[model samples]
Target: MLSIIVALLVNLLIETSVSFSVVVPGDPVVAHVGSTVILPCWINPPENAEALEIRWYRKEFSNTFLHYKPGKVPDMPVEPYRNRTSLTPRSDQSGGLKDGDVSLRLEKLRVQDEGSFRCYVSGESSYDSEEVDLKVTALGSTPVLFLKFLDDGRVNISCKSSGWHPKPSVTWMSDERRVLHPGGVFYSREAHEMFSVHSWTAVSRSDAQLVSCSLSLKTGELKDGRMDIQGIVSSDSSGPWKALFFTLFIFALLGFGLVGFFLYKCRPGKKPDKEIVGDVNIEEPRKHAVEITVDREHLHPDLMVTKNCKIMRDGPGYDHTGEGFPYELCAFGAQRFTSGRHYWEVKLTQENTPPKNYWLIGVVKHGNFTVRDRSALTPSSGYWFLCSDGPNGFHTNTDPPVKLSLTPRPERLGVLLDYEEGQLSFYNIKESKHLLTISTRFSGTVVPLFNPGAGDQSPLIILDCTKPVKSAEESSQPLLSNNSSNA
Candidate 1:
């Protein structure tokens, strides 16, 4: 009976002294680049892990990613995983080292971090380990589409995007859902281990088609963009027929020149009874590009202007003094225009924000010409500007206020102030389309005005238009009065 009891007690001791196995997630842990992730790992049966040696490594046992022991200082991981790796409790388990949680906390995850990690733990008697798989992914930025008219009369559309991991797939499709063959696909890896993709396709211009390009990952991540390519062609993309017609017309002009000379020499001399005495004057719009900067003294308290005075945005939680442009988020340019034509441009998508919906961009009378509300912002009251009220639409601050219909809203707005002509014109610099013109008489100084309305994420940025650039098509067309409102 005594022997039997001793044997049973020894068996119990053996069972209690047995080693514990390391437990890790059965499925691969997924995380995105530039994010933090916890690779779950723990010891079964919950034992104090503080006294045990913990090591996390990649392929080789000698390659230590993270090492910890009770009395020894923590070992630094490999160069790649140096400061980014730390031992912490599993997300679901809060007991940490005391409760046997030995999870690895990785910060600023990189694409190279996607692999198998071995979590090894050792006690006085035995050691065990388990491997955890990590999968990293990155969703790229929005794809940008570029259109080019081929010499063969086909429209070539190209799509480009960057900052994606795992090599995304590209798909080209039409509005009818028919898949089109891409001309070529090219990809390059960036310094950060992310991929940039560029693909293009050529389509006939015979039919109008709405095309789309989609970038996708096997992880069900997608970024897509669409552009209407129907009848898409550059303004000067006329075929060879136009050149042939010009050649023939030049020959015809030469033949007419000879015949006119013959007639002048053969016909009798004749003189007009009255000599033309009136002078026909032709004037072209003069471009006087001036560098504009925000006047810090007159800036609204709620407005935040950059140090360069080029960018302005709303600053919330600002205390109003109830003086000087109260309740208005406005800033005036330091450069004033009393005469000549001054042109400047504002970028509506600065500071990584989306296209602005609410903004007021134009010129206001310099000096103490202050108005309380929209009603007071009129030419008669010395304020002439164009306003964008988001989905409510766009308008000008004329006497009665003229509403405007602008298609494909302007991303880069060009403002021209003809101080002598008393005309303020707005142009969509991206599309080269004239938006509107305000006609009024100017007397004193007028400064460039800007108001980034509330409820927008982007900052109003005034670009450096020291030398205003104008395309041939933009310069040839005259500003039409059909869209103008006389103030």
Candidate 2:
């Protein structure tokens, strides 16, 4: 009887030891937004957990997310995790519930999901709980570099990017890996709780031509952009000649204006014809026509781009493919404009398809083109667009969205980007009308934007705007200027 009692005591001690301890990953599990992850948790001795009560909670035991027990249906998870939570094996090697793998499988992970999760398991007489750390991250858009000529002859190079979670570190370095001192750094929290960062540094002509800016996250995701200051910096040497020519050209223009004004006055009551003036204003954008093609690398996965990258349409798949622009339903232009004027046109109507009633046309800072929501596409966020809501009306994403009444809806839209002049003008090419002009100080490289709204039957076609430019001798009259808006 003494030997049997001793054997029973040993068995109980072994069973208690096997069930009293829980094992979890020592390192924090890292996941990005919109992804799925498994927080590894299991019994130390690998005993079956099917009959044991399992609870996955955060912060404390009462704040449970998932609960399960033997011979009873599992209770509903908390509201935020209604259908996005589940139980699964820690990995392929895990033996699953039969062998005590009670890892929590989280789906559709969000920024708010970053924290500590407690994995608690209990039997009739023994229980164990362990904490697993989770880290959420979001890799934001590429950094965009903007160059501004400071009054003191140094060039102010600004770097900006958006949509990053857990603010990333910005680094400005020369091609030789030398660190640079930034003039200013600004960070703004977007509507979606992501971070947008902008930093600037001034460089002189004597500095190296290649300057690169990088944004890095703790999870090892990094984005970088570079700018060549050779062209801009070298132009400084010709400043005197450029100024002299500019002064002479201005005097010549004044002389011509005076002569034209006197000649018009001499021809008493000879007013300009409205038709001719309208035609000239409408054709002004064509003078700066440039060839533009869609950028496949920056395009949304839901968009099907042609081989030539000139046409784009919505694809059948609505789910993101984890490539290209993860959230934006738009495509970027391959051509980038840092200065001077440029114009391109997009065709909204395709043969055998319904006319496109919904579209978004505009320009965005190069490298800062990805956007998750329309509300974040404001000018302050480095987005300037004209949205057409399919029979609802036309609007601009200004501080307070401006609504415009457009008649005889445009089939082909012309976009004119006057970078140095700080103007973005839209035109109705078919109707020979100047639609609207948005004025804002443009910094950095800007790229054309196009969005064929979902459910639209037609695709957006980028036409080759390489038409011949008109010369001064061919002009019959000066172009009429459109009023500029704060947009």
Q: What is the C-alpha local distance difference test score of each model?
A: 0.75, 0.77
Residues 1-487, model 2: lDDT tens digits: 9999999999998867654588999999999999999999999677789989999998878889899989999999988999999999988988899998999999999888999999999988789899999999999888888786778867889888888999999889988889998887778776446889888898886774899899999778899999998876776678888777545433322233444334435555666432211233656667788999877766676677666677676677666443332237878988989999999988777556656777889999887655676655768567787878776778888755667667677888889898997878777777776666676888888999988776667677777767543333112322211111110
User: Can you give the lDDT of residue 116 in candidate 1?
Assistant: 96
Number of clashes recorded per candidate: 0, 1
Clash number for model 1? 0
- Give me candidate 2's TM-score against the actual structure: 0.56
> How well does candidate 1 score on lDDT at residue 331?
75
- Give the poorly placed runs of model 1, Cα more than 4 Å off: 231-487
Clashing pairs in 1: none
User: What is candidate 2's CA lDDT for residue 469?
Assistant: 35
Error of 2 at 315 (Å): 38
The local lDDT score (0 to 100) that residue 400 gets in candidate 2 is 52
Q: After aligning candidate 1 to the native by TM-score, how far in Å is the CA of 231 from where it should be?
A: 5.8
Worst ten-residue run, lDDT, model 1? 274-283
Candidate with maximal lDDT: 2
lDDT of 1 by residue, 1-487 (tens): 9999999999999987898999998999999999999999999888999999999999999998799999999977779888899998776537899999999999999998899999999999878999999999999878878776778878888888767898999999999999989999988665467887888998888753889999999889899989888745433357586666545433322233344333334546644321111111111112555688888766666677666677777776655453333326777888877898887888787434578888898888775323346744656435788888887778777744667667677788878788887888777766765556677898778899888777567767787666544433122222212111121
